[model samples]
Target: MPSEQPDGRGVPSPSQVDVVVGGIKGMLLDGTLGPGQRLPVEADLARALGVSRGPLREGVRALSHLGVLETRQGAGTYVTALDPALLLAPVSFLAELQQPASPALHEVRRLLETEAAALAARHAGPQALAAVQEALDAVAGPGAVDPQVFVEADVRFHRALAQASGNPVLAALVQAFAGPAVRARSRAAVGDEGALARTVQEHRAVLEAVRAGDPDRARRRMGAHLPAVEDPLAGAGEDPDAGPS
Candidate 1:
């Protein structure tokens, strides 16, 4: 069969699925395919890759899941936009799958955010600063807000902070690391009476530092703020010292 890779042992050397995947990836790397470009017909691609339809389809599906391909009904499969944010979505999912109290994820978040805050302090314009303020206002708004609502605003604030850094790559990295942390923070907020208030206070501090155009202060404030968010989740069903399980 075209899908079988014959070895000396008379066994398949590699799965057809992998062959298809690797072939497409090679096409991508060599510029035979490109972002937003339509791929050849499925049959054509299968023949070109020396694989059968089944394995080619499976490989396409897997690449689609990785945000590397897009299938449009009636048109055919095409390369995705391949934006960094879109490509990093799977990394976000992987981060979300980690333990709720994972310190490693928090460490990554801290590293990305601290640098983002520093950049934001240097680069943020009035509109970006306003966006940050709006996010902060949503979280610290009057009356009682739902924990989920607070979490959403909290995420928006940090994302805005990242965007203000004027670096798309840094923003995407921050977003990828923040997804799971936000979920964990939401859960922690539900149980911890003072979590929301403390979050507002911390966000305010970071915003103030960013607004003042003090890069060092902004970096320090963000570094401090992220760990504070993790404090409530420290002992939640996992050993804080142990790595992600």
Candidate 2:
């Protein structure tokens, strides 16, 4: 094992990790490293960064958590593809930690999804539209009679809508919001007053608008569908997560 410097004794400090992090980030900025590039071995990287192995590992772990890097068993660490959805995926954790944030999450989701629906109406091709319709049918079909099945189907519908929007960043943002939406839907109390039926109808309304190529109506319908989710989440205010499916 390599020995730490005199000042680098005991547990590693933020400064030590910062050295490693800053070094790698500088390399990335300068194009010395890039998406899908493999990192050098630990000893060499530590030597290059002028940091101890402990801090280098911590820095790498931190970057991995942020989806900036990935470590494969025996294959070593490499930069991720840096896709928008992969980077934004960690936002899902926010709802789990602070339950009160669920409404805010839904609001952000609503804004993104409404615009996405409008864009989808404008840009969706036959295949994209078909994909969305298939997702919608899954939500309204037999298996969705089960609550958990309904939640999964509902998420797929939203994901398909986002994909049809032709905006990758917007789609990624919408995908990240799925965590809160699923958490809220699973905990919701559905009724014979037609909660599930109402949801399916709302989805149909959005689909109708999209099929008609009416951007404004698609936006309006999506806007309407999403607010229903917000109220239930607000009412549950900081309730325990039934656990994100």
Candidate 3:
């Protein structure tokens, strides 16, 4: 580690760290490092960048969290293969944690998912369609899987459906919102067997619409599937008394 300067002046500069991380990330973007190639030694890196060890390690840790670098205990750190989706997981977490004060998120999900399901109906290859079916099957049982399990499977279903739409952006967008929202909704719906049954039925309807290649039906079914949960901000909201199924 480089010596810490109390006044925080000079020595291992923060801006210098930024520059080094940016350079390395650029190399990652350009495929210069190539996946699995061992990074140069820490001493080698400091020498190459003309910086002290402190900032160099900090930059490496930051990149590691970004999923652009992998560190092995005895071996060496290396550039990751840089899968775009893997790198975006933190982005998804941030998106999910954004303001939930309004039902705007439900609206967003409704808009994206309607279009995604419709496109999936038309463009889904056989394999993608099968993946959707598998997810549907996993969640088909009468009882909701543990809230966490159900949320995860629900994400897989939506993500697979979004992928079937043939749009990576759509998939990523859906992945971002669905995880947090599913966790919330599943928790709200747990032990509410009626709601669980209704959810399953709605999913089945969406699946059928997709299977029939009827985009209009798919879109409508998706829209109908959005439940009006207890949103105090938006009216008294739909009565909890209403049976879910």
TM-scores of the candidates are 0.81, 0.79, 0.72
Assess each prediction's global lDDT (C-alpha) against the native.
Answer: 0.84, 0.78, 0.73
- A best-first ranking of the candidates according to their lDDT comes to 1, 2, 3
Candidate 1: 10-residue stretch with minimal lDDT: 236-245
In terms of lDDT, the poorest run of 10 residues in model 3 is: 232-241
lDDT of 1 by residue, 1-245 (tens): 23667799887687889988899999999999999999999889999999999989999999998899999999999999888898888788888788764878888888899999999999999999999999999968778888778888988999999999999889999998987787677777878777777778778878888899999888877776676557764433332223322
Model 3 agreement with the true structure over 107-224: per-residue lDDT tens digits: 6777888899999989888999999988888879765367666666666777888889988877877777666666666666665656556666667878888989988778777666
Winner of 1 and 3 under lDDT: 1
lDDT, candidate 1, at 48: 99
User: How many residue pairs in model 1 have overlapping backbones?
Assistant: 0
Q: Which candidate leads the pack in lDDT?
A: 1
Candidate 2 off by > 4 Å: 1-14, 98-101, 141-144, 186-189, 232-245
Measured by TM-score, how close is model 1 to the native structure? Answer: 0.81
Q: How does model 3 fare in lDDT?
A: 0.73
